[model samples]
Target: MTVSVAALIVASPALAQEVQPVPAPEPSQVPLIRMAPAEDEQVEEPQDQGEDGEPASTELPPEPVVAIPQEWAPVPTTPEGRSAYGYYLAGRSALASGDTQQGAVLLQQANRLTPEQPRLREQAFTAAILAGDLKFAAGIVPDAPGVSPTITEAGQLIRGIETYLADGARKANRLLAERPVEMPHDRAATYAQVWIAAEAGDWNRALAAPPADFDPISTLVARSNRARLLEIRRRYEEAENEWKELTAHAVAGSLFRLGYGEFLERRRRGEEALALYTAAIQAGQAEPRIYLAQQRVMNKQRPPATLRYREGVAMSLRTAADQMVAQNANEFAAVYLRLSQQISPNAQTQAYIGQTLINGNLPGAGRAVLAEIPPSEGPLYANARAQRGMSFDKSGMNEEALAEFKLAAEAAPDDAPIVYALANMLIKMERFEEALEILNGPLLNTADQIYEVRFMRGAALEAVGRRAEAEAELNAALALQPNEPSALNYLGYLWVESGERVDEGIALIQRALAADPEDGHYLDSLGWGYFKSGKPEQALEPIEKAVAKEPANAEINDHLGDVYWALGRQKEAGFQWQRVLTLDVDDKRRAEVEAKLKDRLNQLPYDRVAPAVVPATQP
Candidate 1:
């Protein structure tokens, strides 16, 4: 169950670089920094030779050095300013250390103490927003004039959101329109206008033609908002037409289908609703609501009442989150996702939030979010557990990860993804037999991931000395995915080492090298193959290159030593063998290498050329 070198090498093509003569040094010993030329030094251009051979012009004058003022105030003259400065420093330190909550609190204190300080107020506001304390951010908007334009716009947006939440759509709309807070590209302001119009029951005004400058996403949002309003108002025919037009576009994701399904279900078209829900699921939608709706339709029961307004809001937020994710604004995306979750509380939203947290390097927070997914969401709960297991595995908590994976496997026994995850964990833990059993039993029938299952099974079989079965499984994997590098490398190396199908093995390894010429491990395999085929001369260059690329690799070093021994370089052979012993090799390999060093040469099973004679003086 040990992860093979093939597995590691196959995952990264950069590992396959051609070995050069000079050994690659360890990272710590490599000189990475380049010294820059001194600032005051000037480069002299070459001059034409004079008739008397007097070389160049006179030296240029040295640049004058300006004196910089280094003096500063020894102490703050005012007590309040001193306290505020102290709090600012502490708050910035906390924020730099990733304690956003504590930083926000401290910065807010500093802002309160220095009410006239625009920078302090802005820092406190930004920290609060990043900490997801929108209310606090809104409350702390500086009343002082002449603040930064960016901060002012942010303050306006925050106040607008607060008004929307506290006093409903009409007041929020009036406030935003009056203030006219301009965002870059006006995305936020445009969206707010559309949603507020819809919420205010001005369907005609809301459905009026979108502005000429609206981007595709904003246009989609506006149209979808209109369709949703129509659906809510029971204008079924117009709603269906609008939805049909919207969903025809590729950007209309699963949310569109879900909305359409809700529309169909409310109109007593159960079959249509069920079909739409099924289509959504097939399109990779994992929202629990779709599944629940399908179940209700299947049972001939009426679906739950649609929360059209809330759904519209959640969809808008989710769309914004998607855009944010695309732009690599992970923290902002997480905030938008959380806002969407508050409105909808669906499994997909929860999953997005958890994964976003993980991507933002908050694995513990991600796992916590996944763990809170309720059991009532059957498939989603299983998926969440699987996600949680991956988070734990990534964080190096193996036993906890195993526990989570097992729980997920039990909950969704037929799920290929969960089964694969569990099998991978088992393999990593050296539970090869259990891993083989899982892959050979339930996963054998999984059509979607059959190739992966076969590949893993091949590796497991190879680990347990069932070489024939392993070969067969690898061949099957290749049949499923032709030229699959991992399978090709493993099978080719095995064939060459075993002295079976030597020609085919050489060809297979060549094909793999063709695909990834830089792979050092594959180069090693090709070199070994040549040596075993009684071509030590041909084997020398590749083996030398392999060793240079993977300077400390025990297996490659041993191969290099064998090649060297065959070529009559006994002393160099001994050096390579000794180097192998110093590496983290297994006990069996260590003993074999030690024996090779002591005996000067060992009888290898494969055919090789006789060692060349060396003079006694050649030390």
Candidate 2:
């Protein structure tokens, strides 16, 4: 059901002049079919039946999903079974057209009605697989008593993909071992095994021979997966050679192009990678897969296209004008944004452009671009606003950021991440009560959003000084995701701040550090934990690392100054406090640093301060 770029182009020529809408199918045509009658039920054959009273073989094959020269032959209404088959066709049509949610809903309804029909069940399994709901696919696949071996095997393949993605390598290996040595032409299954083996770190198995009659597409996938596995194992030479073999036959619209190009670029073969990425971009358009590939190319220095000026106006500049106010971009990301915009204008591109700007610390510009999109864009609009809010928060404009987060939450009430993000923003603004209300009212009320809601709710409660309630909520979160880093960091930081459970807090921070070694916040928390445990010297290294990673972080700098002072490095501590003042920190924190500096300087016994050494270059 995935629409390839080539297939889209082929379909495009016939769809020119105007975009026409198809008539809605009748309600009775929905995929719902009641289960067939029990086998013992008496039945009567019609006079038109063959000599043995069996249905005639005169019926033609169903129409292809694509448009064709001939009109579809009318199906007989008298046969309920045929009517159910037509519904399955309609469901596939909906799926192929990119209405996957609707298609799956319809297909589910169809399966319920025709539970005994093999073809209907097979169609359902295919629909589920394409939707990436492997668990659902597996459940239905095995229970489909009358389904064909082809479809069941296909479902097995989908399950393998799920296993690989979910990191269930041992189970995946077992499943692969059970397959026949002479595997059938089930490419989906073959690719699933390849993905499983590769992800499981089984490079040898991945590089082995593929099943019989492997299609060209599956061959490329298997080879690509094997190559990627090699790269992971640092067998770069072998991986590069495999990539070379795979690229020659890689599908024009496949996602593998991104992975392949990334590998080539990693190996320092920039020219080859750029060529592959360029080919990928030219091979597809509508799906935006090509645009992503092109964006990657532009990020790596070769512009996706040359910036051209016409009639005294730079086209790229004009595009930027239309888009930038809504989003911000760092140097590298900005390049990707401009190039992607040049090639295609889409919601995702716009969103990414906005995100790039925000992450680059341009809140005002990011908000401007985000605001240009109408609310009718729904989730995309909300996502854009969330990025803008994050930019605002990062730049210390907490009030404005909170407003944007609130709006985003309202716009996407069903999105757990959006709601959780708004909660965090509210907590940052010290509007903990408001955050709690949001979590309790809508986020917690929604069954699908419970875990995230509870986590954020705990954070909000902690911010509001409800320590007991916060601990309880955090405990609940631990039940859901035992080693969740956010919960660990938040609870551990809280304990460190309270000067209680210092050892336990340090242990928790260590656990979080193991999960995300480079996280500045967790590093800061660990440093503070050590400081509280009366180990100032031990705290210095992590605090310095934290400040280095997050150069503009006010709290970390303050903490570093505290640690230096505790260690009796008076001159160095004084310098850190002065540095904290020079940064654009909040007024309250700046006042505290200024007061500390004044108190420290007054207590110094030295007649005069040492002359500061100047650096040759300044940031």
**lDDT values for all models:** 0.69, 0.60
220-254: candidate 2 lDDT, tens digit per residue: 44565556556666788888787666545323324
Query: How well does model 1 score by local distance difference test?
Result: 0.69
Question: Of the candidates shown, which would achieve the greatest lDDT relative to the real structure?
Answer: 1
Model 1 alpha-carbon miss at residue 260, Å: 4.7
Model 2 stretches with alpha carbons more than 4 Å out: 1-417, 445-451, 584-595, 603-619
* Window of ten residues with lowest summed lDDT in model 2: 306-315
Let me know the TM-score candidate 1 reaches against the reference structure. 0.67
lDDT of 1 by residue, 1-619 (tens): 0011222123333432321111111222211111112335452322335678885454663333322113224532245455655666787777665566677788787777766555456668777765556678878875454343344555676677667777887787778768776643144445445566577665565566666666554565566666766766778788899778765754334446666777787788888888888887887753676788788889998666755554666666666556555445455456656656655677888887887767767575567678778878878889999988998898888999999999898988888889889989999887899888888784554555567888898999988889999998899899998887777888899899999777788888998999998889999999999999999999999889988899889999999999999999997887788788778788889879877866765433221336779879966
**TM-score list, all predictions:** 0.67, 0.40
Q: What is the lDDT of residue 518 in candidate 1?
A: 83
State the local distance difference test value for candidate 2. Answer: 0.60
Worst 10 residues of 1 by lDDT: 28-37
Q: How accurate locally is residue 566 in candidate 2, as Cα lDDT from 0 to 100?
A: 99
Which parts of model 1 are misplaced by more than 4 Å? 1-131, 140-159, 179-189, 200-205, 233-241, 247-306, 326-329, 344-347, 360-365, 374-377, 392-400, 441-449, 543-554, 568-587, 590-619
